[model samples]
Target chain A: MAPAIKKYGITVSIGLLAFIILVAIFAGQVAPHDPENGKLDDRLFGPCAEYPLGTDQMGRCILSRIIFGARISLSVGIIVVSASVTVGTAIGLISGYFGGLIDEAIMRIVDSFLAFPSTLLALGIAGLFGAGFINMVIALIIVDWTPYARLIRATVIDLRGMEFIKASIGLGMGDLFVILRHVLPNTLSPLLVMATTGLGYVILAAAGLSFLGFGVQPPTPEWGFMLNDGKMFIRTAPYIMIFPGMMIMIVVLAFNYLGDSLRDLLDPRMKMVIR
Target chain B: MITDERPGENRPLVEVYSLKVVFPTDDGIVRAIDTMDLSIREGEKLGLIGESGCGKTVFGHAIMRLLEDTTKVTGNIVFRGKALYSLDRESMRRLRGKEIGMILQNPGASLNPVLTVGSQVSEVLVLHKGLKKRTAWDRVVGLLGRVRIPEPERRAGEYPHQFSGGMKERAVIAMGIASEPVMIIADEPTKGLDVTVKRKIVRLLKEVTVEKTMLIITHDLDVAEEVCDRIAVMYAGELVEIAPRGAMFERQLHPYVQGFFQSLPDRGLKPIPGMSPSLIHLPEGCRFHPRCNRATGRCRTEHPEMIDTGDGRCVRCFLYA
Candidate 1:
């Protein structure tokens, strides 16, 4: 079990993720105070028996808000990654499988998108679309899918000529079935690794956008929104920003750790060395 | 049990008429198979023997239309009275694996590494035969049993990496014969296996492909002799000689064929002089003339056409002309 834990490295990360998820899911029941409702007298208060982690500028329970913020961050990470991976994988499969002119056309478009620094492109999209939840998600998705597409395309191109893929085709399997059953499954390990790592990036990007007031609105208690609100009281009340900032850092690190470990475990060549 | 209409009739199951396959590289067009003509009779096992890079595999790919679309293929490949080249992509795909199964050279690389051996074989059954999952699994285990794999039920559940070299080949053969194809194209079935394992694989392939039209491609004369009814010797990119297995061993006509036999360990270990000509810049006249002892001025200047020798044998040489 010790060796298995060391080999996988995701056990701790999975526990951390599960804890965060549980906190988010039970925020209403577990939170000591209402995230929205606040008393004027409690404003700028530090940790106490009644209000643990203290109250924010609005005198709302900062701990409760942060707990609720987990929901927003996790949802954004999951939804954005899901949408991008699915769309990107489909395009990559078609482009790499057919190749030739269709490949050329699709790849050139992917290339044009990849030409820009992704963050700058996301920023540009966010600026153009104006501040909103859906627009912010769209911006991140547009930027995020390029990596998945490129990774999947490269993998598909490498695997397209593999004997197993050719054998599947030779076995009279239709193009759709071959792509789904043979080509897609071969790309899964890398895709899984990419998605796990990409989840962290998505969460970070969503928070960045929200910090800039382009993501979930102020009243929503997202970690980024809390960070933005806390930035004002930094000198007088550093704890306000410290808590939300730590949450983001910890979640992102957890995903990164899991992703790295998964790469080691899932890679055939790497597994041999470890064993 | 999809049988040809006239099982005993004297009709060619597959006919290659002036078939040519050329690949365009950065340097120049590589003439892989140049004006090759041959035919495989129903239920006959034809051996395509050639050295490495001699277009034997390319010929098999051409028949299956497995080559990239950019490849320039010309002439006719008629299978069961239908011109294979004339068929559309979809129809051609349908013909492959179901009508003509192909076992590639390397079995290790042929089966999907991630998929279970059972799933790999069952995929063929489901795709071509439309068998349900339950039915495919039962048949897959039965097919594994037929290949003499120990504990077919347990072995089928294992991955390609879990199987040994010989077992992987057996699994690949199981997949190839899963659809019960009318014709099977096995390219280098016994290649890379040790002498003992080679015999076992040869015996296994021979057992499975019995009474089915087969094109077995290899450079091993002994394996060809053991399995093929008639052997077709390919030199450079042309069919130099094709004769019955017994006749090919007894009275080899083409100089290349003679050289190949002479180089065999049991024969003399006499290596053929010079190397196989590069497909990009093939030698003038006869491809084998540069190494031939009986080369004449005509052999250096004009390419010889394949001429019918008596007793259903054919040879390509100026001496024959």
Candidate 2:
């Protein structure tokens, strides 16, 4: 990659992610039309001045639905990531701090979760719980937390032998205090980088489940469900699938790029080229 | 500081009896600290000197009961007439930082980089004394000043990265003495420091530990002579000779101790013959027999125990036996 592209990629990724967040937060006002209420008279229409990006199979404004879909994707991504990170970090700290049988048991369980392809596991879980927004979010969180657990566990294990930690323990601080003050803060930078990429994966996974009819029910206008709604009409009106598909792809790519740039900025191993 | 009037001044503040530390590795069982006995008198400064990897640090850790659970430790450590090994987990935790403080080597690594120096020092007060944060912060500033740090009030708020090497060491020392523990174990506090810094630290150590019992572990003979009343020499996981600072320096008994002093830069600058024996497979009789210039057949086949050489001195060599 050229230096110019590398710099611009970071800028563009930040800009796009910021825009998506703003769009999600203000979906109620930014959207020109009600995403759920459709007009049969203008069904399958292509780009127009009043209803930009044309109409979908329901004759709903594709642009407005895409804007609304941003809300679900972003919220699900944020909620699931936060929940998983919290749960996983806690488990990982405990497992790594007290090694031996406890460490063995926890790591084996984490390994089992990691053995199956994450998406497939999410699919199986979502299928078991039955399709709905909450159930799908639950499924995503269950699969999502395993990676964070493993990441934190590895970091905690590395920090367990650090001189500072041993010193703190010798200072008579309880195990909990040492983990909170010494171990957790050191794990933050890598955790932040991992979370950014994890957010992108979560958003993509949620969309895939929605597209497969295991996520949010219809009339909700989620990007994945919108894609599902437009799939049957792909031949007659390609714009229906193209618009939402583009939205999902762009958002995921932005998050991934942002994560890459963050790693470069935060990673100690990277030779920082200050600009 | 050595008040003969005090009832327990002559009694041992900390005592170890037949202590051994063994680490079972894939290669073999590494006998880090062989069967050893030690005593630290109340209000006395004892310096333990040895070459690198001679189990000086391990012995320090063992005395504090800070060794890993995987290592096989079979011995008795008595602190204040209480058996340390028999203490429950909570009691042991309470004993640390309150009754006994430890100043680890590498002051830079001993402090948590993410935490402010003040907060790190204040944590000891909070945990052991149960002081509130506000009061603890005030005391932390005072403690920092006590350790010779300038502008303690302002510097206390700054993170560890802002402090220099000597300043970080002072902060670590402040943390160790925050609760005014009865005994403090300082492991090579002067190691890795330049002459000027080492002098300042040695002075600070003497000043802060005026009336407190201290165990200073170091390889610097000058440091031991300067700060310690009694000096113990360790060679290959065992004590070779222990005597008063003046006596040990003037008329040391063990060949290893004499060779050690001769190897110093200012002394004859002669290196001891042969390397220290490997701990995993130490020499059959005396651990230092291979490196001893005056070794005999008796020193080769039989391990010698510590022998009393009068005037509160002991030497673990067949010549003394």
Candidate 3:
């Protein structure tokens, strides 16, 4: 038999990603009823001939809702990571490499962002914007970019004085090209690790927002919605909480494991450890 | 000593006079280079030999202007008659890779690990000469081949981490020579390499830079003994002796030069006594007198000015005076 993780790691992430893509492409088809559609008759139906994983209090198929929920979570993780990494990498390369006033100004702003408790800050932004899919994503994106920016900045600082950079400077490569072509690629391995590991952080954060009732609007069928709905009937049926909570644990672990393996493969430094 | 002014022959390419570089620290100032005169003629290979902290490496960095911002430099670094210290940042930048290429001490630390060898070398070509990328890349491969890197085209694609120490140094040489600059400054080019590889690299440097001037800085006397046409001996930030390599060996003057010659392993080995003086808190008067066996009242009380010895050489000691 294959390793539980072989069924789990990249294959799971790729499948999750594909499933998300499919949900986005044909969410109307795979999610049998309208995500908002609810019938009182279907409420809490056990895993019978029709409903697998049973139905939530809304009487919708839990399995169908879970599939659609994956779309929102995965898309938020990807989009937030992409935006944060892009903005962070650029800011970091400039601040670290140029490093005087530009460094000072950027670091000051980044420090202010980091000064707040991260969750409070995200919640504050989500509260200000009012809850919906786009606002939740926007809130996460704003909250997450600072760490990336700061890491990129530090890495750039260390690399700026190196001989290759000096050699590039000496040969007359302008400050721009040197930072772009030479300095930027060196920042990738660490940046990628941040993005993947940070994916888990973002996913968990989004779930938290949903649980607080400020994330996805109700009747939309998200894990946080499922978890919230399950909590009320939890004394009667705790299995409702298990499925969604396990979904969270499994995905977060998969991302973290894949992040570790990716770091091993892409970063030459880590490769030395295992060998 | 003779001066031939024939048109095709060499004139001095760079002259440094009473060059002094001191670094300011929280505790005190560190004197890296004392007032000293040095000159390099066109197409000549000069070697600077000394123990650590003797200011040989500091002097090389001074030439490249690669010192920390805290350091204070006072002296004239005249390159082909223009004062180097006075040049604006842009002019200095233009001069660095194109006019004066340097092969740094630690190829590993100096090289950016991310860039492949070819890309690193080609970077200089494109920057200095405004050569197109493809053209510069081709020249980089040619330079790798010149430095004796096997499968030059293939090696060019590999990062510095992929190459052995010797190969990395070769790539460094390739970077140094890419622009075919007038002067090449190599600081400890062969310090850590095995004996065989050291010999190969030394031979390669001499062979390729036949008509190109080079200032080679190393602690290894044997390599200097073989490769350098002229040699300078440094002690405690002072140039105690600068002479034609053979003459310095034949008629060794100054306590430090004698000590270096005595300390050479191949020449009946024994280590030189004592360490270099701290630049931050140097001894009063003569810096070398503390370690010199021949020290007397006059030697310890006053610094000696560099005295020309009529034989195309100079020494900074009272004995020479």
Candidate 4:
């Protein structure tokens, strides 16, 4: 790819992400109407001067709702990614640094977790816990953490064999010290790339759970919740579903694009290939 | 430099008796070190020289108790009157870096690339000396400067990749000597450097290890000649000869050692014929018999024990016996 095109791709992704975050942060100011408040007379109204993306079945402004939906999606993504990365990295460091029966045991446990389809696992957990934002977050975290654990464990296993690690052990530094100072820092760049990539998936999964009626309840301005609210009126007025669906697609694509660019920038090996 | 009180001139600081290190791989057990015996006298610089696969580095690792857990090592390594292999984990950790420093082969690979050169060196001081990070860092700067690294303060802050190969070696050497360990075990310290750099490192090694006991493992005979008071030649995991450096260079007793010296560029560069035998499937009797020019029926049929030739020399050969 031409450098100019690559640079433009990065810029466009960053711009879209920034726009979404800004919309989320200033939703009240940015939205022309209150996302939750609606008029009974204007229910299922087509796109017009007053309602750009038209009103939902509840007469809620689809544009306003989509604007506010970014808040829930982004926060859920951030919280789940940070929490899972911390848990998985710690477990991975311990498992890889102390290989043997412990490594075997932890890896087998991770393998079992990975054996299940992630979305189905999250669905099962969310179904069991009942519908709520916190429950959905918990479910997403449970499924998401496994991949980070696997990724980090692989990285740690590679790093553990590095001559510097043996040198540290030979230098009389404790295993904990070596893992935290030497091994953990070295694992960070790859972890950052994984976390960025995983963030996009986490956001997509959160929206997926909400669409299935297992996330944020009705009347709450979430893109997935809006899609589910607009489902029945699809044949009569597909605008309600189309706008929120487009929002989800655009935001997810933006996150993934940004993540790819970040990986290319942060990873030295990738940098060589690109240049 | 606070020198430890010297014991008797002949007292061994580190003694290895009948050491055998085997790695049980999928193929078979690789007999890396087989029935080895060696002693480093107090304040003595002993060089262990050998071919690439001759287990010289294994002996260094065995001394430091740095071998892998799966490696089956059966031996007695006594350092400062304590059995090294039998020592508890905590004590063994305490003994390493604080009392015994190990300079590993390949300085570029050995130094942690992520950390600043200074912090890597100072980490030893903080761990063993119980010094605060600030003081440890200051001492690191001093150590780097002593190793003759220019702009020591600035260089200490830079990561390993920013430094050149020779500079990395100096930084590693500084780390080794940072804790003022009683003994230092260096594995091929001068391995992959230019001639001038190798000479500087050798001189630096000699100067820094003046009063401390040292074990140098190298394939470079010149390094051994320049840095060691005594030289011990290893052949296929076994010691072939032990003598003072000057005397060993003057006259080699074992046929293998003779061939080794003759293979040098100035000594007509007559390469020793036949490969060194595989460690896992070592030849019977003398390990070097197949490669010996003077291999006799007795040399092929019976292994020769180390025969003390007096004058602080021992040779493993039927001819000496």
Global Cα lDDT for candidate 2 = 0.89
User: Candidates ranked by DockQ, best first?
Assistant: 4, 2, 1, 3
Task: Give candidate 2 regions above 4 Å deviation.
Answer: A5-11, A271-275, B1-9
Between candidates 2 and 4, the TM-score winner? 2
Per residue, candidate 2 scores C-alpha lDDT tens digits across B158-201 of: 99999989999899999989989999999999877889999999
The C-alpha local distance difference test score for the whole of candidate 4 amounts to 0.89
Docking class of 4: high
TM-score of every candidate's chain A: 0.95, 0.97, 0.90, 0.96
At residue A37, candidate 4 shows an lDDT of: 88
For candidate 4, write residues B163-280 as lDDT tens digits: 9889999998998889899999999998799999999999999999999999999989999999999999999988999998999999999999999999999887999999998888
lDDT at B134, model 1:
88
For candidate 1, write residues B219-320 as lDDT tens digits: 998899899998999999988998889999998999889999999899999999999999999999999999999999999999998888776788998788
lDDT for each residue of candidate 2 in A1-275, tens digit (9 for 90 to 100)? 67787879989999988988998889899998889998988899988998889998778999999999999999999999999999999999898889889989999998999999989999999999999989999999999998888889899999888888888888777788889988999999889999999898999999999999999998898999888898898998989999999998999998888888888888766735644
Looking at model 1, how many pairs of residues clash?
A: 0
Question: Could you give candidate 3's per-residue lDDT for residues B250-295 as a string of tens digits?
Answer: 8788887888778777776766678777877788777888889988
Query: DockQ of each model against the real complex?
Result: 0.76, 0.80, 0.40, 0.80
Q: Candidate 2 — which pairs collide?
A: none
In candidate 4, stretches whose alpha carbon ends up further than 4 angstroms from where it belongs are: B1-10
lDDT of 3 by residue, A18-71 (tens): 555677567768766655565779888777777767777877777777777777
Choose the strongest candidate by lDDT: 1
